[model samples]
Target: MKKKIFLVSTAAALFLVACGINSGISSEQIGLRKASLENENKVVLADINYSAAQPGEASVYDRSYENAPPLIPHSTEDLLPITKDNNSCLSCHDKAIATDVGATPIPPTHYYDFRHNKSMGDVISDTRFNCTQCHVPQSDAKPIVGNTFKADFTNKDLLKKSNLIDVINEGVK
Candidate 1:
């Protein structure tokens, strides 16, 4: 009985060794980039080309999904680096000025404090002040990985706009 068990274990080990040897994967072919795992110099990144349209001139992009943050369609070269003292986006995108400037208003969710569950009045919540954290400028670069996922929205309006404040607490007790 002992001899039979030893033979079976030895055969299994040898089979596993043979399978590993037959596996054609190498260290360079391991990841999606197809570059050497140990060397960073050989990896070449795809170029990112962002839209050069000025604010309020670029066409708006549809939301990627329900309540997904809207992408910045225009060049943000002048409006970036949102410091506490300076947020150029508010000049047009603030709730008060957006409509007048033909820009999408900053959603009500940006003004409400979720942690304390209270309105923050006209001021944007500290957590939501940094636009780039959730929103990014649209780019004309090819995707690293192919995406087959499609977004389905119950309301057609949600495809172009966010209703996050209205839907945030829907299922929550």
Candidate 2:
């Protein structure tokens, strides 16, 4: 009897793993909601302090295309990515649906034609398969570790005052 019970439990575990339809992050990581810790992390719903109260325009996770990547606001482990024929972003971004979900939908950028792609002969997955590759959520929460980033913008005047421009004008004097 114990052997049968273990077999059934193992099968169920395999099935869930095969299905990517789960929150990609843990509750403790995102800081809200409830979940079980058995093979997954958990959080108490009461622990939630803030929420996406009202849905607005579809969010663009990566604010600066040249800088950091965006993070997901909600769970996306369960979401299916876009492929050659399917773009699932429209599923939630249509104002009719996104407003109800309390999260923004995909922005018009998704509609833009990205020249980036893989050659069919190369057998690569469509470049869009990994949404996280480009877009990322900006979290207000504290950093997971000490930040190393220092401001280069703040030092702009340092160069302007150095008379360094005149030196360069001499061309290696």
Q: Candidate 2 overall Cα lDDT vs. reference?
A: 0.46
Q: What are the runs in model 1 whose C-alpha is more than 4 Å off?
A: 1-22
User: Residue by residue across 82-139, what tens digits does model 2's lDDT show?
Assistant: 5556655546654356677664544333333346532333222345445667654444
Residue 73 in model 1: shift from native, Å?
0.9
Question: Which residues of candidate 2, in runs, are more than 4 Å off?
Answer: 1-69, 80-89, 94-96, 114-129, 136-145, 150-173
Model 2 earns a TM-score of 0.30
lDDT of 1 by residue, 29-130 (tens): 888889989988989987788999998689989899999998899999978899989989888889988999899999999999988989999998999888
Candidate topping lDDT = 1
For candidate 1, which ten residues in a row score worst on lDDT? 24-33
Candidate 2 residue pairs that clash: 21-78, 22-78, 58-105, 70-136, 70-137, 71-136, 71-137
Clashing residue pairs found in predicted model 1 = none
lDDT of each: 0.90, 0.46
Clash count for each candidate, listed in order shown: 0, 7
